[model samples]
Target: MSPSFCVCRVRVSTGHCTRCARCASSASRCTRLPDPELERGVRAAHVLRRLGSDFVVFAEPHLKASNMKNLLQKDEKKEEPEQTVPCDHKTASRCLLNLMPVVSETVSGTLLNGTFLPDICLEVVHDRELSKLPFAKSNLTVVLFADISGDAIFCIWKADDKSTLADTIQTVVDCSLNIQKNYGEWPTCIGVTLRVKIGIATGMLEYHFFNDDFDNVHYSASGTVVEYVRNAEMLCTAGDIILTTEAWNFLEQKGVHTRYTYTALPEDMVKVLCFDPSVTEEEKVSFTSAFAGVRPALYALNFEDAPLLKRFISPVVVNIKTQEELIFLSEMRHVTIVFICMPEFIDIDLATLSQLYRIISAALKETDGVLNKVITFDKGCSFLAVFGLPGYKGKNETCNALMCCNKLVHEISAMNM
Candidate 1:
């Protein structure tokens, strides 16, 4: 990577910062925001973010690094003077996925060359792993599906956890393929060589409500130029551990060595990195053991949807672990939960309920805020929304809640149904 001259990273106005390639300014001056006392009431400018060589906004609209004052005032006339209690029952869970055989029967009805992993089951397993990861880590989940029965077990490190941990799951897989010559008939009973194909990838984990039911959600990973792990598993023979470029890069960053470039794709298509087990048993033993007590798991990906209800909200009331912990967290941060409900949902037929769901979804969108966790009960339809999330800090939580609730109500009322 050669250096270029564009280095003007200072803001001259709201939501806009300028970067000049031929800049000769001091480093400290370039990164600081314009003092609000000196530069106020400026026009809103386009947000600029650099991606690779060029700066652009790709998908989700991210606000510029600045505080936003609540413009929605309580003095405004309200059709409904009272507010309903927000849905604060449930929370998110952060855990590393065991990635065990959660769906053997569903994916392996017919064995194909000792490999029968279906895509749906693959995603379901990914979702299960994602539910355990905590917030604060990059919410990126990478799945490396082992060719042996489509099982996966990776490790993760919380952003706050500093202790070193081993990915025992990877070691177990490495050990299973080594017991062939241990004088045990386990391999003979299995009737086949236990080879594991490991593929690693980094991608976006996206979700949408399943059949308009927030309780049931579908999650999928989309990696950019790093989805080779899925394809690499098909070409590699069993007992082979193949790592994608993405995974190898991560390992390189972590200073974990147990890998060598085994070979290249037919025409240099993609580089194949592997922890060659064919090396002497001593080396293989050192290889797997070399990774123990490493900070952050090599295969761990954190699935962070902060506030738990950032996308699909679950119904299980999250029992706060301890009252003191809850009180401490509340004191440190503040968020207003909003629950949207349709009072007549219970009496309606399925057909009518479907129509009502569409109406409510549209109303939520008009609020310009995310619908965190949504709950549909027998009595009515409800959504749980938090005003101020962990990383995202707005000026006023109450104003945000009021504005969101008002916008949703106004949209629903205008629907004429």
Candidate 2:
């Protein structure tokens, strides 16, 4: 007769088996040889041990993968060539371009594909005050700021010499039109309508780098020019592209031919540009063809090298061990938003900043809060955290958020001493 196998949770180590209390009575009679079903059950038990009951839902997949090898073979067979679907090359390019900020390497391919924005770095002085920086250079730049349904912010800027003013104007016009037309049709946005608001500004920008970490250094820019674009972006309605007077004048001066029609916003101060419903295909081709050969440089931030950046955006990334957390949190629920700002944090020494980050990270972890976003300015830094995600239905999220904030204040204050 085949040896009886125990279906209870088992922990195997050093050629010995430790059984849970529930199965201890049958431990002496259980078989210990390899069995696919037994192995799958063991894996699920281990997953539950490591990730807690919250991940019990994900364990089902591990249990079902008892025949993973055969499943992989079936998947390989499905990869055989089949009839292809026609796709829009331009729309594909735009989609890839939109992801440039998140996936750094794609920036090169995106630039090579079309007349996109040029490469430019906004420098921030690290571990030092900008007022004391001895050397700085000012460049006339056109900055473009895009807000995607309040989910993410994309900022791109180019110096005047990188490309002609006509090319810049044409590029933004093309961008605005593409977003308005194809954004909702994309696979990720198919069921939802995402609003894309754009703001453009042209002004003098001052930038410089710091010597904090030579191996992984980043630069930042200063000047009211950034604020101008940010304000213009905030004033924008869905599908609206607001341009500052300076930016508008640059296009007017360059005599750029665009199919967009401009109208002064009903307010006394802002200028708005909208797609022209009556634009002829001939006119679109006429303006778009002028920059047919344009290839602007694309310099994107390397997120892999930035540990702080990774930590701040950790909630959005899924981990194999705790992927269920993300899956469970991906729904709408009431959450307490916590915004923390460190004014003049740019001048803080790297050592102190590292300590502060650790303190805040520990506090948030203790309180079960999630960091949603982070932004670094020339003189300051701010981060957004949320509590009471969908998965934690029983926990008092507001209490957790308040506790986290209280701990941050105490810890940060002690650190400053």
Candidate 3:
């Protein structure tokens, strides 16, 4: 079973309450007492009935139905601004100046501390300019993490396909450099000092999407490679592509080293090497093997056939309808983050999964919450929701988060699947 929990200041388990002082205050709001055996029986019956009938018919109508809007709460407060407040772009930029570093430290503390297998991973760092780039494809899996103000995007390429790992690495590098070069040419970006940090690491990852609806697709990756590449990107300097030792070694082994010019970093600065003993001796043999590197500009990089890369770029930017929306996302504000995990979600049917996504998205929209990120792995899926961000009903963030979670739990339970 998934360990259901809520995060205010700290994690508070909703299913099994420890009743510690910190979580005790919110205990009543967080806890959900559902009979597991009964839930399983009902869910099994529902699945069996749907399987007996044409489930597609049931799923299709609900997906296109206008009644999904009715699921949202009607009585939203009118006082809050419907649009993002106008602020100097410079001021907005400063609000997020310290954002990336803080995000990197948190990721390091949580996900990157584990040991794992090495595989090639690439990152493209960009400001809002590269938002619409199609980076997802069949062989590539995109995982998105929303760090309140921005997203931490990672793309992992599956090795089972015909394309060589070298192809994956080079393509990502080429595309990233191309993006940076284009941004450099933009008149507004010339003196602004905006930089994109693309990090590449070689490590293990796994992913699969529930359906073909790419717009509604919630694709994510799991395992060490995701963490490794994320850390690599976060540690990277602006305007440079950083590579973990594993990625570097893989490239050299493939004899693709001559294509790009790269300088190795000092041993102390090579963070991937310091991780648990997964680092092989040969991978550490050369000082010039792994580090920040520059590549020749490829102005005409095309995405016509790169579906995996397209997936990588999808969730990084979505649903931004205005410049005000962009500015709003840039502002730093205290918000409550609610993380929802369904450990046994792998057993749920794809139709149900899609339905769940829509339900959650609509719930957050109605409650003045932002559905920040959705992470799917082999066993289950998790969602990140934020409350009290600008351009929404800004009052009572913590209360809103709890109420939304509670509502979701009940609504999802009623789905009985």
Candidate 4:
């Protein structure tokens, strides 16, 4: 028999059961108590009969009452509401919903301690001349940093009259892809959005550097320049580049002629006006001097290296071919020295050899010598040095190399030059 069906003894006294209301209403005798061992059987039979009656009650229309209570509990949970997440331009523009994988990959490796986005925004603004009147362009470069979920939006004016907004965005996408291909690995999570906002303004390039830490700093642009750009973007329609009156006036003063309406503010409305002629002049001189100095040095480096030279130089001021030729011509008057060292072959001291290698390496670095070759053999002969490289700015790499090479040459000349 099943464990639940095991039989047990039960005693019943009908005379005593009729005196108790609970027992009298029952069909079975209920007044007699069995021994503790047999009580289990009595309770089981009573429970079965009560359950049968309960089952019948549950089958009636009132069964829905329990179900309705559960549903009401569920409804209360539903009515409790959910929290909304804050949105940002970065998330809004380049989210997976508008995923542009190529753009994301392009800016992924940019070193941003929170400053790359702002710089990129300024670059886009500068490139498009958004500060100019009638703003004629509506292109933007969006840079998103995944770690901080921060975004930077840059708008360009007058990219192409024939292109649609989508085409302009695609152009930015293509540019970003090219950047990634040329510059090595970028952050996989970094994203880009294009042509999302149009901005135009005319103002001085105000500079500020944000200190991420003692070792990290990022440059930013702000002041009236930022405000006007944001205002212009707000006033602009989708795919339209807009400019503020201040930006238009600034462009006019800069000799940029454009037809655009302007609204003059009351003199009292102006809050701040500060000018620094020294700063502007300093910036002009610095840029001019840097280009003047670097151009000549770059030309010389390219000229001496020729076919093997392309890898080391950057493409600026001219195309690779012209730059190479210019550098080659500049090397016509330059001289190159090669130093090779040979130590004694007798005892063959490995410690001395290691020390000598370290010395040569340090001399090369100190002299700014780009070590082009190193060849050593079993005879204790070492060939090391550089050729056709720029002098170290102040590190004295050339002098250091010459001094070290001379010492080694004097020591080894008796054995072998």
lDDT of 3 by residue, 30-52 (tens): 12212222222122212212211
Q: Candidate 2: minimum summed lDDT over ten consecutive residues — where? A: 59-68
> Which candidate, 1 or 2, would have the higher TM-score against the true structure?
2
Write model 1 residue lDDT over 134-203, tens digit each, in one string: 1111233443344433322221111112111123223322332332122112132334433344444444
What is the TM-score (0 to 1) of candidate 3?
0.39
Per-residue error for 356 in candidate 3, Å, reads 3.7
Ranking by TM-score: 2, 3, 1, 4
How does each model score on lDDT?
A: 0.29, 0.39, 0.37, 0.26
The candidate, 1 or 4, that scores higher on TM-score is: 1
The TM-score, computed over Cα atoms with residue i paired to residue i, of candidate 4 is 0.20
Residue 165, model 3: lDDT of 59
Candidate 1's C-alpha runs over 4 A off are 1-138, 149-194, 203-218, 249-261, 267-417
Candidate 3 segments exceeding 4 Å error: 7-76, 80-85, 90-137, 140-164, 167-250, 256-335, 342-355, 362-368, 377-380, 388-391, 394-397, 410-417
Q: Report, for all candidates in order, the number of backbone clashes.
A: 13, 6, 13, 15
Candidate 2 lDDT over 266-349, as tens digits, reads: 542245455556765522211121111111112222333223222112332222121122121111224466767677564444
- lDDT comparing candidate 3 with the true structure: 0.37
- With candidate 2 superimposed using the best TM-score fit, by how many Å does residue 289's alpha carbon deviate from the native? 18
Model 1 lDDT, residue 87, Cα = 15
Candidate 1 is scored at a TM of 0.27
Among all candidates shown, the one with the greatest lDDT: 2
Winner by lDDT between candidate 4 and candidate 2: 2
lDDT of 4 by residue, 1-417 (tens): 000101111111211111111110121122222222112222222222221111001100110100111111122323323222211222212212211122111111121001112223233333433223111212221211001012122322223222232333223222222222322122232242222223444333233322111121122222344444555444433223334554334344644222222233342111111122332321110111221121121112222222222111111011112122211111111213444535343232333433444444454444444333222322233443442222221233345556656654544443331
